[model samples]
Target: MFTAGHLAANPLPPGIVGALGLGGYQLLADIAGVGAGRLGSQAFLLVAADPDPALPDAGTQISLHQTRLRDESEAAAYVQLAAQLGYLRLSGYRLAPDRHGLRSRINLVNPATGAIAATIPDRAGGRLLRGGPGASQLLVTAGALPPAG
Candidate 1:
């Protein structure tokens, strides 16, 4: 359940039906925690979903046909790989959530030079802009916090 503030912080592309799903969310979390992919919300990462003959009774994987995927880990991996393979042009987010809520790393891309940079937008405020000198993005992932002393 996304809150109003979260929604405001991270606006979705107009007419994009459905949410980023739990699997997608988990993938983003893993990315932030493990540094698997770059993260950003500044630009949309183009993704397309396809069927994997591995899920059991995975309940209609129709949304995948166009990357309008449901919350599934397999789908997330597939998309992530696609992004990396250049099958999809990803200039944003090596580690960003499907939606915004807590802080998450955002991959900021310099469109003009095709360069990429990472930014922790204070709290995943949706903008992937480089935080002025020394500023950083903070992400809250499941069990990512250190044990309190």
Candidate 2:
């Protein structure tokens, strides 16, 4: 489970605002990413299951943990991480036969409002990747909105 504070530290794209329940987990939003006319707060509910190297356990159950991305630089870093995690779905890893490098499809919606916000190519088999010093962070930017017209 993730708190809003955690999201604030990382990020949920720009319009997602933050995540609530990841399937069943309840997420809390902490006021950490809101400041100086910027959206900087977020919290996600995730479960981290123990990884079984034996037969590919195949799932994770993250607990309530917190990490912060205070400034835009940090936020950009997060975005970069997301991009590296093959989030964009457009220019990442190459699928099987289409090794020519085609973009995947990505779509993030507000489950509450039934609204579609972000859309990118989709990955053949999209799954959450691990995070670490040289890993891509799965910062969901689903509900965020574009600047005013």
Candidate 3:
């Protein structure tokens, strides 16, 4: 998980902002074009209720995801990564389809279906890098796939 600091900086699509009505909610992460599919793809403005410690799985049960777009691709992801002037700016991987994988400080395949690898998270570990009055943070969780029989 990553902290999205530019939620309010970029101009989000009007219809989406209205649909989620996240105006007063606690924004967790704001993803730009991280998802994809046959029809199209989109971005996300993740929000959630206050963190709940009562949940299971290493206090990670409490998470947030708000889909914001469709038809997203490596190119779009690259654009988002490049366009951002924040910590995640240098993440753009040259927009090459052959090497089109999502990356953060930690190296992992982009979870997007059409990403570098269309693999799903099977297991993992995570840590809270930061929690503040402002500035979203990138959290880490460790996981891997099981052995095939």
Candidate 4:
């Protein structure tokens, strides 16, 4: 169950919700963990319940796992490695870079409809933006992350 206090205690970084445009979804779970490394970076796993537009009673769930990196350069390196390993080619996903080339993301396209089903941003500043159904239209609205302090 989601609660106001829980969200207040573990709030998502600014612009995350608007970036993903998760307006209608309901928060289900939020888990934070330590990244595997000497730095012991922070990581988070978020699960949300997404209501299906076609079927009122039927719904789906989406999850996003974000890791806090040391900096934008480190995050870019991680995305590059993932792409080199052909991880982005799985399931008909194509790698797309933002206009500024600061971020790279994998977009999953539906074969039948050719509509984007999901988007996974593997970019700088330690954000892993994952999107589910109805995300295709919103991705264009996602702006760059704020400068790291």
Task: Name the top lDDT candidate.
Answer: 4
Answer with 2 or 4, whichever has the higher TM-score: 4
- After aligning candidate 3 to the native by TM-score, how far in Å is the CA of 118 from where it should be? 4.3
TM-score result, candidate 1: 0.18
Q: What is the C-alpha lDDT profile of model 1 across 24-66, one tens digit per residue?
A: 3212311111212212222222322122467432111111111
TM-score of each: 0.18, 0.22, 0.24, 0.24
lDDT of 3 by residue, 35-63 (tens): 21111222222211122367431111111
- Total clashing residue pairs per candidate? 16, 34, 22, 0
Cα deviation of 121, candidate 4, in Å? 2.6
**What lDDT score goes with residue 52 in model 4?**
43
Rank by lDDT, descending?
A: 4, 2, 1, 3
**TM-score between candidate 4 and the true structure:** 0.24
- Candidate 4 residue lDDT tens string, 3-71: 333333544434554564433323332222101111123222232222246645211111222334455
- Clashing residue pairs in candidate 4 are none
TM-score of 2: 0.22
Q: Where's the lowest-lDDT run of ten residues in candidate 4?
A: 31-40
